[model samples]
Target chain A: MKTKERSSENKICPLEVAVNSISGKWKVPIVWQINEGKKRPSEFLRGIAKVDRRVLNQQLKEMEQDGILTKVSFNELPPRVEYSLTELGEKLVTILWMLNDWGKLMIPAEED
Target chain B: MKTKERSSENKICPLEVAVNSISGKWKVPIVWQINEGKKRPSEFLRGIAKVDRRVLNQQLKEMEQDGILTKVSFNELPPRVEYSLTELGEKLVTILWMLNDWGKLMIPAEED
Candidate 1:
């Protein structure tokens, strides 16, 4: 897939770009699922509750286009497809872990 | 400020919470500005280009409510207000820096 084209006149903000890349509703959860060793679309549907098939497919396709995921298809009788994180995607998992920790802090302590 | 209430039935996902907290359009920019030591609202308005007063105030208010910022108001004739990142907010800055670095990788290499 071709890399997304940015207009020459607009200056790029890495933070904004990073956020935009993962802004889709199921994108983070998809990444989280893949990080946890779930590779197929069926596995993702089972893992992330409330995500419909069409939405999940769209997010997966977008992530692949964004270079965060690599999709491989097996040519057996029943076709099987698997997705894995690229090097860049692995780097993103590190950031996601940090964000998860930060999120823990946002949760208030249980009342006595 | 009182902490936001989460429903008892719903389990919290820290990553989702973190993303929701900063999903507002100018939220990240506001955080970036504050990380740079721009305390007052006027300073944020000036530092972040193209953000109007109303939108800026809303983002600042949301961040403050999310515990990412601490707001201080002075009782001067013309009220003086300042915002600074909390400990949580500081931690978020470290993550933001990492995200910024990752963003750099998304940019295509210069063609010969």
Candidate 2:
């Protein structure tokens, strides 16, 4: 039933697509969290402050669907699942690093 | 009274700060519009689709406060106003271009 990854539009705006891909506040944090080696959902909960399981899972699911993350589930007693960033996700990290640099510019030297 | 620029947190996460700086949907378009030589609000209204004046002004005000844009008012009969990107704003444009390129990768070649 689900042939297309995301909804198709006549005139797709790439910027909008980019913005929509990482729309939620939790997303960037989640991406950074993955890059920082917080793989499992439990690890994510511990790393990111105030994010509940349900919401965290939801964001993770969306990211996976968007091809930014790849999730693996192992059949264990406790059930273990880990997520890794794809090539597309890695490219996003590069952009985010640049954004972090830009964000630093907004901070005054005295403040830092 | 308002001396400080934007709110200062003790531990400023530059990534969070960067994401927060461009939270709204209209901001990227607004930046692009300005770059395309749409200087005034009236011009912005025509350039960006489905954006009302109030919302546009709100986004513009926030961008200006963030130092991404500088607003100028001309003393005339009909009143004239213009907005231009600051050096920082120009920096943002460079990043946005990268984001746009990253965005292109998400689109399938056949679809595009």
Candidate 3:
């Protein structure tokens, strides 16, 4: 058996890298909800069960800047800001679902 | 501000909690590789791009104990060890893919 050498540079497990990338308090849930089709600002605010609007807004902007989300402002009488996952962001939803599913399995259903 | 009270008990962002749960160096990648259909012990060792045999074995065993992977050993001259994702383990793949997708978006392609 020819043993292959592991690369040292990409040493950190990708999930850990993912976790550290969005380590903020609200990004994961925010990303999760956004992927769930809550595109409008108000919808995002209301969709998350426990996050405050202020923190939600803050996290959203940061995500947008981070390229995880794109903020589109439609020009109309009442200015509307629509938040959508970039192609990159959309790709994340599947993973979040897996996480949610795994969490349910790991933790007792009653505790969740 | 109708701030819904955020529970301190589940304070850690779910992703962070997820990260910590499988923080071992090889678990995430191992999980990812396993989720990708590398079920046998030899396949896991060969599939991962860089993991060492010793570390991979150690990590796989740890994950198995953590309820992430299930190992089935068949009675034979050359013991047939088959590994598969437990229900909880299966759920983590989507999240892992999301993390992989996000990594591509966040990190420059050249670096990855």
* Candidate 3 residue-wise lDDT, A27-93, digit = tens: 8767777777778868877766677888888888888877889999999979988888887776666
What is the model-wide C-alpha lDDT for candidate 1?
A: 0.91
Better of 1 and 3 by DockQ: 1
lDDT of 1 by residue, B16-49 (tens): 9998998788888888988887999999888888
Each candidate's DockQ:
0.74, 0.68, 0.27
Fnat values, candidates in order: 0.72, 0.50, 0.41
Ranking by DockQ: 1, 2, 3
Name the TM-score of chain A in model 3: 0.72
Kindly give the stretch of ten consecutive residues in candidate 2 chain B with the minimal lDDT sum.
Answer: B1-10
Give every candidate's TM-score on chain A: 0.90, 0.87, 0.72
lDDT tens digits, residue span B42-106, model 2: 99999888999999999999999999999999999799999999999999999999999989988
Q: List residue ranges in candidate 1 displaced over 4 A.
A: A1-9, B1-9
Which candidate has the top score in lDDT? 1
- How many times do residue backbones clash in model 3? 3
**How are the candidates ranked when ordered by TM-score, highest leading?**
2, 1, 3
- For every candidate, what is the interface RMSD in angstroms? 0.7, 0.7, 3.6
lDDT of 1 by residue, A1-112 (tens): 2344444535688899998999898999999999999999999999999999999999999999989999999998799999999999999999999999999999887774
By DockQ, is 2 or 3 better?
2
Per-residue error at B68 for model 2, in Å? 0.0
